[model samples]
Target: MNKKIINAMLVLGMTAGLAAGTCTSAFAEEAETEEARGYRFTWVNPIVGLEYWSIAEEGMAAADAKYGTDTQTVGPTEINVDEMVKQIDAAVAAQVDGIITMALDPTALGPAIQRAVDAGIPVVCIDTDAPDSARSYYAGTSNYDAGFQAGQTMAEMTDGKAKVGILMGGINASNMVSRVEGFKAALEEYQDMEIIVTEDTNADLLIGTQKAQAMMQTYPEMTAIFGTSSTDAQAAGKVAEEMGITDQYCIIGFDDMEDTLNYIREGVVDATTVQKPYEMGYLGVELLVQTIEGNGPEEQVIDTGVTMVTADNVDSYKE
Candidate 1:
């Protein structure tokens, strides 16, 4: 198996440090909320039905229960910018106390976010972000940094030489793009690491797998595959294992989904980037509520931080 272990020592060390060092109030078990009574907030999820998004929804529910706030969760079953925009518009028209959303597509979601702010609704973007939008706060991972680490991790796993293929959820999504940019920047340090191609899966697992297979077939030299969306790594690893070429590729994924963990355990995926969707959702509500009460903090961004997961330490994450 050419599937080498990444610098497991480095990964473990960094993970241990990031566990405490990346502290932000948002990651706290409870972000401070005071008298949020009668404040009805709406959380707009771009992919409401996907398993990944469900974690964020759980966080929203936890925050709602803890703070005694009414949060209305609404979105399309699939990732639909038009439906998300319509939902946001509806929230604004309904005059909800505040709104929460993820910046799946900055250009498409930006204007709607701004409109909500212009209409006096305090908006918070979680998990993903649209800095250009009028969102008052962003509570989630700094995607670029996460991607950078992913690139570095890949370099170690592939011994600093790999024909890389990147699978993204959406090419136009700012957060996903940022991860790609950071990934490219990190790989620039290694002269032998080259990105051969990038494909968009629209965050669909089947499409991701199809693209992964296609990329492998086209770029026969590709030694590493990076997935910036949750399903990308699963796609790559699944294809590699099925094609009997898992040894030829070092597979990296985003987020710690259950199936992804199983892949790591089975020696299919080398590692993955772990983001706190639940914490992001939980913190987003508090940020919105704070802004509603006119006590909004000066800092507009509440980074939830990110960490790396690998086969060596995947068990720790599973529990």
Candidate 2:
């Protein structure tokens, strides 16, 4: 990658830490006596079958219940950018007050997002971002920092001498690429530990497993794996266990899914950085509602932060 592109992406990551610095609860009181304005917001996800969105839905429900905001969740059964854009267009046509969505591809969702913004409907991106789009705010983890932290942890565990491979959800996804960049940046000091291969999963578990298997077969000496998505990490652990090499390699993954947690508990996955999808969904709705009501928080980007879950803390997150 060109140095300029890398720097630009890093700057995009840094934007997450910049905010209006207003507390979320401060605006709750602002809505107390207002008539149930009943603003409707639709949350468009890339896919809805994954367990990752369950908590996010819960967050949306909480916000809706508390604020009387009408919320609807919609997405395709799989990663179809075309279907996602159609949904966005439908929401725009309906003139919904707000649209909360994840940008699976940076450019695929750009026009739909722009149309929404042009229609005076607020669009707030959560989970993944399309920074060039006209979205009002981004609420999610700093994927670069998440990847950097994972890289630092990998270095510590492998003594900076392990060969590493990567399992990614979508090769072109902005969030995934930024994570790989951050991971590479962190590993710069540990010259002996280098990324040997990166395989795309296309947001599919079976594909993720197949890629993980291929990576293991092609690089038998590989001592560590980085899963850039929830499915990728969970599938990597499953593949390693099926091959009976769980003890031979270390797996560091993103998201705290049940299988990922089990992998950590069983010592198959060394560690994972858990994202607060619940908060993303919850705050995403809140922010959009505020924007609709003219009391939106001053923060442009809300960094929900992440938790590094290991065997020691895995049990606690189970609840």
Off by over 4 Å in 2: 1-35, 317-319
Candidate 2: worst-modelled 10 consecutive residues by lDDT: 14-23
How high is the CA lDDT of each candidate model? 0.82, 0.80
Worst 10 residues of 1 by lDDT: 12-21
lDDT of 2 at 244: 91
Give lDDT: candidate 1, residue 18: 21
Per-candidate count of clashing residue pairs (backbone under 3 Å): 0, 1
What tens digits encode model 2's per-residue C-alpha lDDT throughout 12-62?
Answer: 232211111121322222335334658899999888867778777766766
Model 1, span 1-319: residue lDDT tens: 1222223223212221222112233333455654548779999988877877787777777678667798888998767899999999999999998999998888999999989999999899988878777888887888898899999999988889889999998888788899998898899999999998999998899999899999999999888999999999999988998999999989998988788989999999999999877777777887787787787556666666777899778876533
Clashing pairs in 2: 20-299
